[model samples]
Target: MFISGVHHIQLTAPPGCEPDARAFYIGLLGLDEIPKPRSLQDRGGVWFRTGNCDLHISPRENDTPPGTNWHVALRVKNAEALRRKLQEAGARIDPAPEIPGWKRFFGYDPFGNKLEFLEIA
Candidate 1:
């Protein structure tokens, strides 16, 4: 009865992918990386912040490949520009998006995590 919006969305990354995650989430997506607490930093993961949302990336227990349709949709100011940035970074981008109410597209990070970006109309 008292649940607020999501405090954070935690996604799994394979071990030792911080550089790749950093490149995609920060270098490409433009989210600002945050420092994990000293107690948790040794666990091997990364954190990011955008507005009020905190994104936490941890090591996957199974370390399997990412699947289609399982992705995080981020509201962006200019989705097209981000898509172009992804292309230039050599990240795998899905075909042109066809969703309503948003100019959007999907892209995968170097470690094969799915991410979606959309600009709400």
Candidate 2:
């Protein structure tokens, strides 16, 4: 099987919550917002870009299932600062920043989507 790199990852959020999603991902985590194609705006969503990875958020028609392990991970220059920014923005820190070969930490978005950051060494 020949497979190229990941094209993009799409995550579902409860309907009409794009603003909050934007606040958390863009306002808090500091990921750059990518403009979605005009054709997709009516569907209600937002896009974020970090290096080659794209994170797409779409409105969920139904409740997100329990125990779903979907998430997006980002690599940053300083995991501790990122974690601090997230904490200051009122995000719940799941795993506090730690240095185990790589400085890292984990947190959840407004809708409980898992997010992690790792410092690039």
lDDT to native, each model: 0.83, 0.79
| lDDT for each residue of candidate 2 in 85-111, tens digit (9 for 90 to 100) | 888888888774556678777788887
RMSD of each: 1.8, 2.4
Model 1: lDDT equals: 0.83
Which one wins on TM-score? 1
List residue ranges in candidate 2 displaced over 4 A: 65-70, 96-100
Reference-based lDDT, residue 35, model 2: 91
Model 1 lDDT tens row, 7-118: 8888888888789888878877788999999999889989999778899989877786556778887889988888888898788888645767768888887767787777
Candidate 2 lDDT trough over 10 residues, lowest sum: 63-72
